[model samples]
Target: MRPREHASQIPPTRSASIETVLVVTMDHLPGYEIREVLGQVVSSQARTRNVYREGVKSLRGGAYDPAAPENLTRWRTDAVARLGEEARRLGANAVLGMRFEHREVGEMWMEVCAYGTAVVAYRSPAAPAPDQPLVAAETAHPAEPIDSGAIAEAPSAPNLRTAGETPTRPD
Candidate 1:
């Protein structure tokens, strides 16, 4: 049997491609379980407006166009596309906790960065079964829940400050 080819080489069908490389701002995705915790993936691009486009805009009395750099839709699309490419390189199917940021490099140039944690996610297989507490048929009250020590212990540390003294690290 032959192994499957890379997903990028073969374009995904519409419905399948919609979820192929998800980029979500949320830390967790609904109905999808993260199977692996891949490391960070980042992509960035810097761009300046085309001289011809700027000339056209100036000729039009500086009127706003949907594609202007200030509007940034094009730059964002390019950056996110690059980000998805990086995630795919990592063998990740989705990117979680994704974020976008921009910085001005000069009077005319700006840079945009897209970053997130790459992860492999699978659709949740089954609806969770609601757990029912075992109880006596004749009991009028619910049984007390046992303490499972789920709460984490606080780390041991010295006091933040001593009385009549500024808070400082010990010598």
Candidate 2:
């Protein structure tokens, strides 16, 4: 039987269409305020592996290549893109705490899943102009100074003894 050609290799030049939605692994985006939480979003992709090719390659004493088409990185990227698209469809501008998961189905199939919390966020307004210096309120109660004499002394360290030995008075 003729070996099947490797398919589903993501072209290096093609964009994943992830530009519309912002994705972050953190729960909150710095400098941006979340206006609304739109709930969780997820995407999944499953691919079949050519076990014959892999078995033949292993028999030939060839080590698996990390960059080969069999690697799940490409699928993971696609999953993230789909996740972003889902977020966009839900009217969310961003996905926070983005995460990826991988699973194997029996022996020939594998799946990649991506998930995150969708949210609508906007850039936070700039800090108030430097002209208005922040000041403490005059009516606020002041903290009282600590008095050294009023504090109780720290307890002395306990004497440690060996497993079966009794404490002996000093000679």
Where's the lowest-lDDT run of ten residues in candidate 1? 1-10
**Which tens-of-lDDT digit does each residue in 1-171 have in candidate 2?**
100111111111134475557778999877777877889999988878778767877897987755556467678778888987888788777789999998988788888899999877766777545476532221122254444555322234233455346566889
Residue pairs that clash (backbone atoms under 3 angstroms), model 1: none
lDDT of 1 at 140: 33
TM-score per prediction, in order, is 0.57, 0.61
Tell me the whole-model lDDT of each prediction, alpha carbons only. Answer: 0.68, 0.69
TM-score, model 1 to reference = 0.57
Which candidate has the top score in lDDT? 2
lDDT tens per residue, model 1, 1-171: 011223432233233323357778999977777778789999988877577877888899998875765458767777777877777777777789999999988767779999999887777766543474433321333354433654322234334566447565889
Backbone clashes, candidate 2: 0
